[model samples]
Target chain A: MSSILKITDLHIAVDGKPILKGVNLEVKQGEIHALMGPNGSGKSTLAYALAGHPKYEITGGDIEIDGASLNELDANERARLGMFLAFQYPVTIPGVRVADFLRHAVTNRRDPDRKEGENLMPMREFRQELRGRMNELGMDPEFARRYLNDGFSGGEKKRMEILQMAMLKPKFAILDETDSGLDSDAVKVVSEGLSSLAGPETGVLIITHHERLLEFNRPQFTHVMLAGRIVETGDASLAHELHANGYTTVRERHPAEAAEEQAEREETLATV
Target chain B: MSTVTVNSAPSLPSGFTSDDFEVFLQSRVEPVWVTQRRRVAFELFQAKSAEELDPEEWKRIPARAFRPEKFSLTGKAAIGFDTAQLPLMQNRAEFEGAVVHVDGSATESRLTEQLAAKGVIFGDLATVLCQQADLLEPHFATKAVLPDTDRFAAWHGAFWTGGTVLFVPKGVQVDAPLYSLVALAQDGVADFSHTLVILEDGAEATLLEETASGSPDIAGLHVGAVELLVGKEARLRYVQLQNWNQKSWHFAHQCGRVEGNGSLQWTVGGLGSKLAHIHQDVHLDGRGAEAQVNGVTFAKDRQCLSYYTQQTHNAPDTRSDLLYKDVLTDESRVIWRGMIKVEPEAQKTDGYQRNDSLLLSPTSRCDAIPGLEIEADDVRCTHGATAGRVDVDQIFYAMCRGLTEHEAMHIIVQGFLQTVTDRIPVELVRETLDKAVEVKLGIGE
Candidate 1:
């Protein structure tokens, strides 16, 4: 049976303020989902909550894989359960090489019970596999030796996130704005990279505003978020309509949620 | 356990009294000149010990509990004590020569025949001093690490014991590195080991040395000195790994002088010791001379490690670059006071010094002070120091990729030290330092 990631009535808050209010969604292996929303719509909050970020308080939620709940697990435990998050703003870990970081991640993902300092994958085999993956992603093999995300360009950082997803091969991968702040060519690269990496056994959730990303990896299901909640669920054509048009039509159809989003914007603006 | 006698009673003053010095001198068989130098140093030690230590250097370092009377110099080396088990760079790479000293006595010293044919001298300091007195007399104490600098220097100068010495003849390049191990195995043993390396004009060599205790429970003391003299147009790479047990007290004055067109690369790894304070100096003494110094220190538990470093530019066109990285955890503390000085005649000199520290726990503390003094108007000098905790975001990012919290922290701490590690060119030294870091983090084999 295909592994299932079930999210039921998920409520998440940041610093005591509700950002994701009663979000319910279910994604299974091999399915591609697109999450679309305006700014402050809690799109990223859901992504962080699913990855078990400590800062994202799960006020009321049940996130599970197969049958085991992940609400109590930390980010690392969730990662070991085949959940991966491609951060929109990838962190720079100075002095840590890309190859070394990926090797550690890959080893842990393969053997979840392995303790720290235990044997990692053999260097010969790991190097071969990493080299092959980098070749497939069109990344310079020299990048393997460079420090992770240190002194990298925006496009390079995004591509690195994709590269990590490829290496991890998570059962459910969430790309949180992995294609934002990139040129069209870079977007095409990331889009095509995600398309190639998300295979039959890998479930992908693309969190992006760029049409180029959805143009390549056409999602089977599209979820539109508003006011910290999933206000609408639709198909690929709805994504196309929302892309060609904008959230204005969706807001017109859902006035109550739109008013709540307006109220959130006013409160944020007042504080700023 | 030893009982402490009250001061009211006329107890032979706790540590290194005149009686102890006289007896120590009687045990050594050396030339008249060496004895004369020791006597002078002994007088200086007496005078300096009476005076207060420099408040500027000792104020931050706590030494109230350190009782010198508790430790005494051992007259004999421990039998069957294995220096190989201390482990830093031993058996990690091929070396042209190797030396082992335990309890301030030479155990094993050897130099490859091929290198010895090239007039390269590698042996214990005691044996080398007796055999090659004429060749070593000029550079031994006359240059770098003078005895009168401080009480510890004077004490070490007077009671200096067996250590490793490397001498490369002018223009000969000893490609492979050399290894030295100074160890202590018995409780209350004082190992005053000295390391001296000399490279003549256009000569090149590399030496790696480490200090260790036979076991963790042994309480020992090390009052040591290191002097490196690079002759004109020569090059030398020296690494000293200080990995004593937590019950050990280490005090050392290390200095390096680079002559005209010569270069010296010095790397220091401070891993173990209850409390250690190292005074390190690098002198660019001639035109076009250069020195690159790198330090990696990890302090944990209640340990306190301090470094007072100086880089002096004395000639025109000289260059010196120094970088020190430290990691602290538990209630441990690390202090770094660095200074760069440029003499008036050292015009067009380039000097750079920086220290970065990573604090792993809330209770851990780090104090970094960087200063510069310039007498030359046409020189470029810059220094900086930064102390910060490991970024929680970086930890989260690593955890999101599947590393446990401890593993993530270990990796982050290693990354923090990678900047200095990159400056070192020796693969064996780098790997050994990495492995040592793993051991300190309580992980790895």
Candidate 2:
């Protein structure tokens, strides 16, 4: 499998409100790329649009896995092609235990040709692997029996995301603001868990607003986005630079583009 | 043994009238009380003009599925063929005994000698009526469901046949469930059935009753009645599953009475039928009594099903809780109207009821109506209702995990229904019902 996710001049909108405007990026296998920007910079939108969310229309450009385009595929069809997106806020589904839900996902993800009504994995093998993953992530085995993300705390939900990631082992995975709302302790635990699961076979795109998540995974490449476009790219030190100086330096480094975007926003506001 | 052949056996596009009722009575030689009750109900049935029964409550129910005259009252269920020859139920190994009624007759039955030695009588009501008149005379149509309640109730009283009665003596507890299958084996046949269950003081038992029909092409009529009496501290779990074909129309009145310290759990599943109107009510008449009415209904195609339920806390310290969930697809429709009432003398009564429905198609409809009538000051009563489509985020989340759209929706829908199906207690029955739900959703084998 060609473990690379290619995006070219991507543009997206939510109900006709354009969020990602002319964005370009590439994430290759064994590389953890960090996309850091302020709130409303469209980091989460890019993540959702990549995952084929129906609400986020892809009006321009394309996203390709390997050499094939994903524009025509539905979310589940895309999922079968080895793509996974952990939501900023995982949806709550009550009365469905975590173990059962994960079993369905694991089988479908692993066995591309598996048919419905046939269990993908046996109970014994699934139970052993699930418990092993839960223990590795410091998750109580009891959480597997609980309803999926229903009434789960912020820390627990993040842990659940990591647990699913460990189980599905997707070819390409995107973590969307997974570090938000997590305490320092939870961040440390979740970061360590993600690090242990990351390797050469799986490409990852980590979208975040701060450097707290970068401290654990320590991305090799950092891209700073503003006004729905990537304005700066540098080595790992760029994360510390942005953390130390915040977005002021990044904004000053691209003054003309910043002013152009500012004038466009004012023009749009005046028209409204 | 006596058998009666009533009014002319005719084919469809016709209906039942007063003359048919007269012929039905003339053909039978029953006790005076039975005849008198039937006469009273027949008169009431004849007197109910379309306008008199035109209350807003009955408006949602469409015109009767089949006119009465088109159906033949072939007498107490006497299936010309043995019920064992039919393949309706599977896994009969767990039951202590079983009874099967088809085409208006009891064809196959297994009443264990151990149960009979315990003085437990389980069989067709017609047979029980002849052999145990003392037991049937006082309690029949007297306590749980009255004979003169409505047109359907009176019609069932006048022409009911092929019913079952389960009587458990004081302190007798059956270890395994007693199974009964009432099936319609032919087209244009009407079945007016009654199921009576009585548990004496300190008695306990479980009954799994299944109601089904032959196929979708068989346009049948079923007007049924069920009465359950739980004596002091007695316990009972009754599971009623209805799987009629789309060509069948069903209307039933089911009621239960619970005495002091007794508990009753009624688990129902409605998976078939073209159009059904069901009325279920439970009365907690003694202190410390409790009753629970939990059910799941899955409907597809043009099926229309409505349930009107009541939970009456008539004694102090009594409690009643009900939860009814439905899943609808295609152009199907569901209506749920539930009321919880606390009497003035029923202090410290706790009552709760709610109905939730999931509509898969935009054109499908669900009307969930919940009401509370509180006459006691020291009572806690609450009613809740919700009707909405399936959650898109839930579906998307499932899709993200590798399930196809249909698979995702099916899993989520099954989970939505498992909230009630999981409480069925019997492992085989629960799995069977789950599979039935999947089939209704057009998924799984």
| Candidate 2 local lDDT, residue B247 | 82
User: Looking at candidate 2, what is the lDDT of residue A16?
Assistant: 94
Model 2 segments beyond 4 Å from truth? Answer: A16-18, A252-260, A267-272, B1-15, B26-32, B49-51, B64-66, B75-93
lDDT of 1 by residue, A35-61 (tens): 998988999999999998899999997
Model 2 chain B lDDT-worst window of ten: B1-10
Question: Which pairs of residues have clashing backbones in candidate 1?
Answer: none
| TM-score of each predicted structure versus truth | 0.95, 0.92
- Which DockQ values do the candidates obtain, in the order shown? 0.77, 0.63
- Candidate 2 lDDT over residue span B35-78, tens digit each: 78778776665544232454566677664334555677676454
Docking class of 1: medium
Model no. 1, DockQ: 0.77
Fnat, model 1, is 0.85
Estimate the TM-score for candidate 2: 0.92
Interface RMSD of 1: 1.0
TM-score of 1: 0.95
What is candidate 1's lDDT per residue for B1-445, written digit by digit as tens? 2112121113333557788888989999887788888999988877777666787788888766677778888868898887767676887876768998889899989999999999999999888999999988888888998999988899899999888899999999999889998989999999998899999999999999999889999999999999999999999999999999999999999999999999999999999999999999999999999999999999999999999999999999999999999999999999999999999999999999999999989999999999999999998899888889899999999999999888899889888888899889999989999998898888865
